[model samples]
Target: MLWETPFGHYYGDNRENNGNYFANDISNFYEELIKKCNFRIGEGFYVNILKNYLSILKEDSEYLYYFKIKPLISILECEQYLKLSPNKEVRDLYLECLNECSSLYNKYMNVAR
Candidate 1:
């Protein structure tokens, strides 16, 4: 499920029993899996999850940018507000993800245009 928070939009698995946010059957499946991992790995997992989607949907740059890539970037931007104190490993991963996302924005935004 996708929620519009004060921070930004976020994806969820509808654990709250409100409803599931499925754009389509298969796409939602992949999104749900990525979201679960993101939560488990404490948000820093966004890098690996973004990579997974890139590989899995090799020809779908637009989808990756709009769904996985953009949302993850927005989430990271809200880190200061979230006030999360991640371990060293997670912090490193988050930094790497930020760097990669910057490159990805350049690469994918052109495709989107």
Candidate 2:
């Protein structure tokens, strides 16, 4: 259900009145994801939150429609960036995250069509 709040109108889960508020803007939504992570990337926009962000995109069709840029383009940029990481550990993590991101992106694109 939809409800109006001081922040704005939000889509709330009908199961619970105290359900989470999903922000309409990408920046606000990104902030909420960051709050749940232990490690944060100082540089790079979507790369830092690739997996989770794409997962959110798959779940919210409305968000994908209004997003400024195609998420896969950003994901491709991140893939190029992570590909150059000299460190084996970072590269390893990148590979894992990239796989999940690719899957999520596919799901999102299919739904979008």
Candidate 3:
């Protein structure tokens, strides 16, 4: 099952009823699990979740910024956001695309400013 939040979605097998954990905490737990176990399940699950999220966001004006510009700000604000990821190589490629989006946003903002 999945729980939706302002940040993202959280998932668990049978523990889906546990409403105690915050979304970030759940994400961190999975990240740590992947790091420790090199578990394909955790990584694959999160990747699928993220892809689904991006697809949904792509159709929404409010959230398209997240899949587009905000992820770059996330990296520039904290490289560890993706640099410390277990899937660092894939995340790095995502960061590159985010950087390009960031640049375009900057240019757009400058013109508007």
Candidate 4:
């Protein structure tokens, strides 16, 4: 299973550890989604997935708090994609992810570092 976040999608060995998957799955998912769907659908679906994962993380701070650095990596990757994506919607979605990832990165950097 994968937990999608504004920054990117996270895949785990199982639902119990999805947060652990972090950047790997998210990067792959973003790449594939961009290729497979139109800009509007792809962007909308990606954002929706991210929102769902954020909600889940909010419910269990302990589980996700430890993995804050992952969002930073995801965000950096998303920013790169934003520059390359031709679709406006997809680019916007990547921008959003970059913003969220930066926020999360800052929030957790003190502790994680």
Candidate 5:
């Protein structure tokens, strides 16, 4: 649902303004997706939503920190993140986030280096 949020789109190319809004949307979507996963909404269903969420992050250079940069950095600092649910499918979704986020994260990092 968070393809290109109203808030983020309003901010447009203004990274400074868009950052916080994008960050909020990213954080909220992740948590909401976890809730959906816990509800046992089916792996395939949530996977599409999660993929869309990640796609939003990957494509938006202005708010890369929220999706690609900050999350990977936190994982690096903490070594690992929490499991959203004990269910296998839920865990799979979580891993998918990590995988997709990491791909974008690596891409950004490589360009920076």
Candidate 6:
């Protein structure tokens, strides 16, 4: 599967040796679970990949610059706005994503402005 981000695009194969990995399928499953929580989400489940994607951009760094975090901040802003939607379920789902995003930032990608 291919994962694209603001930084770059990554190409990876699920077929490693003799085993066939179903990572994207598993991701789709999570995506569905999270999507069920939000009625208005456009991109489906986006909860699991941001950190891993960013880590690909900076393997050795424990922190990233504020400028380099525009993508994350944009997602955070969207989550905040989504939390205000009339749909209670979407708001709750956005809240869940927001909380998890915050935790990820605090743990792995401390922004240095």
* Prediction RMSDs, each to the true structure: 13.4, 14.7, 12.2, 14.4, 14.3, 14.6
Per-residue lDDT tens digits of candidate 6, residues 1-113? 45532323344663362122345555565565555435544554433343343443343334444345657657666544454455565566556555544554665544533
TM-score of each model, in listed order: 0.35, 0.32, 0.33, 0.37, 0.35, 0.33
lDDT of 3 by residue, 1-113 (tens): 55555445545664745555565566886677546434432545645644543444344344234445565345345433444455764465445545554555655576667
Candidate whose TM-score is highest: 4
lDDT of each: 0.52, 0.51, 0.51, 0.55, 0.57, 0.49
lDDT at 52, model 4 = 52
lDDT tens readout by residue for model 1, 1-113? 45553333465766554333323444555565555544756645545764553353343445355466566577665542122334445455555556666666767667779
Candidate 4 segments whose C-alpha is farther than 4 A from its true place: 1-72, 75-79, 110-113
The predicted structure with the larger TM-score, 1 or 5, is 5
Higher-lDDT candidate among 1 and 6? 1
The stretch of ten residues in a row with the least summed lDDT in candidate 6 is: 14-23
Off by over 4 Å in 2: 1-79
Per-residue lDDT value at 52 in model 6: 45
User: Candidate 3's C-alpha lDDT?
Assistant: 0.51
- Predicted structure 2, TM vs. truth: 0.32
The digit string of per-residue lDDT tens for model 4 on 11-103 reads: 545865564555566777678665644553453675565455445334433424537547545544644644456566555655665565555
Alpha-carbon runs more than 4 Å astray in model 1: 1-68, 80-86, 109-113
Q: Clash totals for all models, in order?
A: 0, 0, 0, 2, 0, 0
lDDT of 1: 0.52
